[model samples]
Structures are given as C-alpha cells and as structure tokens.
Target: MVEVEAAGLIAIGAGIAVGLTGLGAGIGEQSIGAAAIGAMAEDPKFFGKGLLMTVIPESIVIFGLVVALILLFVF
Candidate 1:
C-alpha cells in the first residue's frame, strides 16, 4: 500500500514537472516566435537566426520529458 502511494506521488510529481516545463517553453517560444516574425518581416535574411532562436526554447520541454521519463521509470 505504501509503495502504491509513493508511486502515485511520484507520478504526480512527474506530471507537474512536465506540465510546468511545457508551459514555460510555450511562453518562451511565444515571445521568440513573435520577434522572429517581426524580424523576418523587416529582413528575410533573419530567417535562419530567428528559426534557431525559436527552436532553442524547445529544449526545455525535451529536458522536462527526459526528467519525467526518468522519474517514472527509475523511481
């Protein structure tokens, strides 16, 4: 019974970690995406830089997913 409860808590924690990270990534990406679009509108040459900047925030979600998976499987 205790093990079950502990597993449930761990699951909850994992969910929270992933959810909060995803939210943060979304917020970060939103600002970057807006800037990217604005910069692209002004100069087409900024496309590569803007795309790189926009994609950088996605790493946060990837890290979060890895952590969640580790927590679920290892703990």
Candidate 2:
C-alpha cells in the first residue's frame, strides 16, 4: 500500500514537472514567435536568426520530457 501511494506521488510529480515546463516553453516560444514574425516582416535576412531563437525555447520542453521519463522510469 505504501509503495502504491509513493508511486502515485511520483507520477503526480512527474506530471507536474512536465506540465510546468511545457507551459514555460509555450510562454517563451510565444514571445519569440512574435518577435520572429515582426523581424521577418521588417527584413527577410533576419529569418535565420529568428528561427534559431524560436527553436531554442523548444529545448526546454525536451529537457522537461527527459526529466519526466527519468522520474517515471528511474524512481
């Protein structure tokens, strides 16, 4: 019974960690996306930089997923 409860708690924690990180990534990407669009509108040359900036925020979600996977499988 205690083991089950502990497992449930761990699952909950993993969910929260992934959820929060996803939320953060979304928020970060939103701003970057907006800026990228605006910059692209002004000058096409900015596309590369804007794309790079936009993708950087995506790493946050990847890291979050890794953390969740580790939590679920390791602990």
Candidate 3:
C-alpha cells in the first residue's frame, strides 16, 4: 500500500494556484487589446481610458496570486 503525503498534495494545489490565474488574465488582455485597437482605429482619443480599462482584469490574477501565496504559507 502507498501513503499520500500532505506536502505533495499541497504542492500540487500550489501549482494549480500558480497556473489558474493566467487564463482570465489572457482573456482580459485579449479583449482589452482588441478593444483598445478598435477604439484607436475609430478615434485615438480613447487611448488612455481604453488602456486603463483593459488592464482592469489584471486584478483577478493578482488576487489569485495573493491567495496562492497565502495558501503556500498556510499548509
């Protein structure tokens, strides 16, 4: 019989923790980049607002990272 170690389980979860965030981030950036470019195509004046709004999705990734970090230290 084989026994599972807590550390190994925690390590696996940590890896997931690290990877899961980038999905939404990538989606966010794609939309933002596309929108920003579209806005630019229409009118260059939206450059600032478009760029700022595009990066708003970055918060999700950052929050995930913080949670992962906390988990890493927790277990």
Candidate 4:
C-alpha cells in the first residue's frame, strides 16, 4: 500500500512537470509567433530571425519532458 501511494504521487509530480511546462511554452510561443508574423510582414528578410526566436521557447517543453522523465524513473 505504501509503495502504491508513492508511485501515485510520483506520477502526479511527473504529470505536473510536463503539463505546466507545455502550457508555459504554448503561451510563450503564441506571443512570439504573432510578433514573428508581424515582423515578417514588414520585411521578408526577418523571417529567419523571427523563426529562430519563435522556436527558442519550444525548448522549454523539452526541458520539462526531461525533468518529468527524471522524476518518474529516478525518483
């Protein structure tokens, strides 16, 4: 019973880690994407920089996944 409880808690922690990160990244990406589109509209040359900037926030999601994996398997 104790082990089951521990496992459940661990799963919850992992889920929170991933869920929050994804939500944050999505929120961040929305603003960035809008700005990128705006900049690209003004000058086509800004597309590359805008795309790079927009993608940076997505790395947060990967970090979150890594944390969740570590929690689930290592903790």
User: How does each model score on TM-score?
Assistant: 0.92, 0.89, 0.78, 0.91
Predicted candidate 3, C-alpha RMSD: 2.7
Give the TM-score ranking, best first. 1, 4, 2, 3
Q: Any idea what lDDT model 2 has?
A: 0.92
Off by over 4 Å in 2: none
Off by over 4 Å in 1: none
Q: Which digits, one per residue and each the tens of the lDDT, describe model 2 over residues 1-75? A: 999999999899889888998899999999999999999999999999999999888888889889989999998
Residue pairs clashing, model 2: none
All models, RMSD in angstroms: 1.0, 1.1, 2.7, 1.0
Residue-level lDDT for 72 in candidate 4: 92
lDDT of 1 at 35: 98
Worst 10 residues of 4 by lDDT: 55-64
Give stretches of model 3 more than 4 Å off: 1-4
Candidate 3 least-lDDT 10 residues: 1-10
Per-model tally of clashing residue pairs:
0, 0, 0, 0
lDDT of 4: 0.94
Task: Report the C-alpha lDDT of model 3 over 1-75, residue by residue, as the tens digit.
Answer: 133576677667767866787787888789788989899889999999888988888887888777778767875
For 34-61, candidate 4 gives per-residue lDDT tens digits of 9999999999999999999998998988
